[model samples]
Target: MERFVNWSGSLAFDAERLRQPTSEQEVIDIVHEALDRGGSVRPVGSGHSSTPLAETGDTLISFGRMAGLVGADKSNGRATLLPGTGLAEAGSALAEHGLAMENLGDVDYQSLAGAMGTGTHGTGRELGNLSSTLVGGTLVTGTGAVVRFGEQADSAQGQTLLRAAQLALGALGVLTSLTLRVQPAFDLHRQNWMTHIDWVLGHFEELSQTCRHVDFYWYPRSDRAQVRVLTLPGDEPAISPPGYLKKDERGPSYEVIPNFRDLKFDEMEYMLPLEHGLEAFRRVRERVKDRHRDKVGWRVLVRTVAPDDAMLSNIRQPTMTIALLQNASLDHEPYFRDMEALFLDWGGRPHWGKKHYRTAPDLRRMYPDWDAFLTLREKCDPEGVFLNDYLTEIFGLQGAP
Candidate 1:
């Protein structure tokens, strides 16, 4: 049996069984078998999520063989891909047809299904999350029913089904394939430099308005912020600075978007309302610097994202993301708990894939469409075969049969 461990070693579990499904029908059959055996099923991707959303002791499923671009319609700007395809592969495949995903997270290592299912997003004030690009997908429900939802929505049910699948977190079922809304290939002008923390907070609004993508790291101890900005490709006009202050990388969006990360750390991020962003950052920075100095080992990451309508998406409004990442060597619970408390007081919504402690009732108040998502989940998987302890607690689900 293969050992189950997350990328950061933050989450690990021993499962009763592991299954890899290669085709849509295979995924369906596996679901049927798991239900028959009265076992919970969970699908894992690159193990990139910091949360225990994927940890299950029974019937762990892998789509290792169910990967790659299955189809593409360049004229319609849509691409269908198997669930296990990685972000890097999806980018390359889309580029082949003069297309690209609208935006992508900094880490390009997550699987397409995993990223969308968890609401992974990139930093852009005018851009939506990865799930927003999910116009269609095929899912195998808990009862072993194979259903497909797509763009040419003939009914309100199909539209809601697609919306629910956007960020369902494996609660609805297993996603076999996804169809994304693609854009024409483009390039980016990425500029990065380390500046003072106060400088970043002071110019936050201005920075958000001018850049296509803006993200930064706040080292409260050093009182500095590593500010990075990506500008869309156009010869509009620019002045050059010395050495590494500005790197002009002009290529496909896929090539320029991701910042390769080698360090391993556990992170807790919250999606705060844009209006509440600055004050919340000030409070969290103070907590990191003054109250939790001994526990907070890594810097704070900040980014902005536009509104997305996915039923469970964290970015329900134009949101600002603040991630507190700590070295895996330290105890993150104390620091993370404190930070979450502060962010929540400011009306922040926890990123689904990151560390968060909010359960059903609190989460229900956060998302307006929460009830609708739960209704769909029940409708699709009454047996609760798709749920694990983590999901059950978070969703406040009834006891599994």
Candidate 2:
């Protein structure tokens, strides 16, 4: 058996075989063989997801060999990228063509397909998650058929399929290529500072609304927080209190948007209604201070994401996300589960790729188009060739091959 482990060293599993395919035909062939043998095929991309979405005891397909920019259209500001291409690599490639991703998460090591599939996002009141940038893509369905959505779609049904494919959690099929809406290469000015949590909570609304991007990390041990904001050059600088400025710099959008994460940690993030975000954070803070402060050595992250139309998107409406992170070497279950209860009371939805304790029934109630996505998944992969034990349970599927 071949062993696989995630970036954070949290989830690990063994597979019967691991196959790396360099072409679309090879992916189709792999699926066909899995179907013939009545086995399962799970796709792995950087293994950045802390969840068991990629766990499997059967065949594992890796797209690392089939990476890089496939094509670019400067006139349309669009680019087609191989699914395995890392966000950092894609950014540099797109820059060469005078293009860039509109927004990106603080971590850029995830593959394009992995980020899209998991609804990864950055902080901004107006910017949707990375999946929202997907305009089209091609996937090898369970039946060994090539399906195209987005720009290639010519009808209403095709467009609907495209929306479902936008964030299918790798349950629909294996993505071979993705077409994204890019923009002319641009630059941004980033500023970071440390402040009291009370001040951040009081002024967060003003900061988020006036800045292009804003996020913060609140330490449990100390009530203090570190706030970071990004703005396009020449934009009015965000209002700040005296002596809070720690670092100020300007660089290309790609370089400035992401922070370098050197420490590994386990994380559980939930998206809640913007209206209830502050109160939820207050309650979480109280609980952490009252109970879990001794065990929590990492900070809590708060960010916002704009609403999007993807069927399974976490942000159906404007959302505020609160993430609980702990050192990878420490046990995270007790603290995460305790915080999760608070999030659920506030109508929270889990980030698909992160650690969560929700089942199909719990998730179905959270997403408005849950049934619609399931129907599409069935149409695309009726045989369930892509579902492993973890996906099978969450999707509420009956037997796995």
Candidate 3:
């Protein structure tokens, strides 16, 4: 039976079997079973990734059985969570301990593991992506061997393995649990205003530096920009939200950071160097006006993330991610492809879990650590038990037919 589909319903697969393992031992056993059967396995979380990263031709594994807070390190401000733990749930748990994940994207539906695995990030010029906070991880490898990374391993290979695994996209193994660096719970003062596209560009650098979290949402068809900024509460008082925005809100950092995502859409996000971001936006604006204005109503979200060294992370440079959105009910390929071309011309890197047109060869040139990641993948999952068609294609493995 076909047991699953993604949130956007754009990607789906009929796995020969579906397994939700409640324990790490079960995960290890499933890997062994897939190996024994000469079939590959793919791990699925909340199915938040629009790309087919988790789609598999054989066995599909979901970590829902292992959901929720597993443990916490009060002294060091860390939390070890089962991969299936929902972001919002983890946020609430962290709050109880006077802590929270350092940053978060607007939508909180993704599992913690999925977020960390795919380089998911919040908008903060000084803050890094989710993978950047990974202090340790435990996973069952393709060889059916359980390995602990981060603090557990004491060699250069182990450290390199941690860097690769932080944003691995499941090519290496099935992550059972992860330890993340957290911070004390704090309040934020958020403000929203509707402004012109030109104004946002004119003050891009200044605003980005001043605000802890800021993003610009522009509807290309309409040519209007909604400027949103979040900062620590200060001597200033709350103000009314601008007419174009939902509302100005303030609360716990995690609670205030994510907006309710009721509108479903397929997305393609590309990380461009800060210097090229505005230029790319201008080009996309011209192209949208000249070619595909009618197809877009969903806003283009542009946000920032500081650099990090997770091998597959697109946040390797202080960058801005331009996320193009399309209503899930409509065809998106042509529009996304056009934007992909624009991004590529700007030397941008695609977000691993989002829609994109890059394969192994194209990606290798974009990522300096691409070959290194492939080497690690080979050593960890030599038999390809952890690979799916998408992983196979990206990592240059022989995809299972």
Pick the lDDT winner.
2
User: Mind giving the per-residue lDDT tens digits that candidate 3 earns over 1-401?
Assistant: 65578998898778888898999999989988988888888888888899998887688888888987778877888888889999999999888888899999878989988888888988989999988999887878999888888865777777888999899998889888888899888899787778678777887677888889889898886677888889898723233332465457889987899988887899999999987888888888898889889878587899999999988888888898899989999889999998799899888999988999998889888889988988888888888887776777876766543
lDDT of 1 by residue, 1-401 (tens): 45799988899999888898878888888888887777788999999999998888888898878999988888898999999999999999888888899999988999988999899999989999999999987888998888878674567788889989999999999988889999888888777866677666776687788778888888767777787778876732242222246445666788888988888889899999988888888888877778987656788889999998889988888899999988887888888887898998888999899888888889989888998898999999998888888888888885755
Query: Would you estimate the TM-scores of all the predictions?
Result: 0.96, 0.98, 0.95
Model 1 clash pairs?
Answer: none
The TM-score obtained by model 3 is 0.95
Clashes of each: 0, 0, 0
- Once superposed on the true structure, which residue ranges of model 3 sit more than 4 Å away at CA? 235-246, 399-401
Write out the backbone clash pairs for model 2.
none
Question: Which residue runs does candidate 2 get wrong by more than 4 Å?
Answer: 236-238
TM-score of 1: 0.96
Q: List the residue pairs that clash in candidate 3.
A: none
TM-score for candidate 2, residues paired by index: 0.98
**Candidate 1 wrong stretches, greater than 4 Å:** 235-248
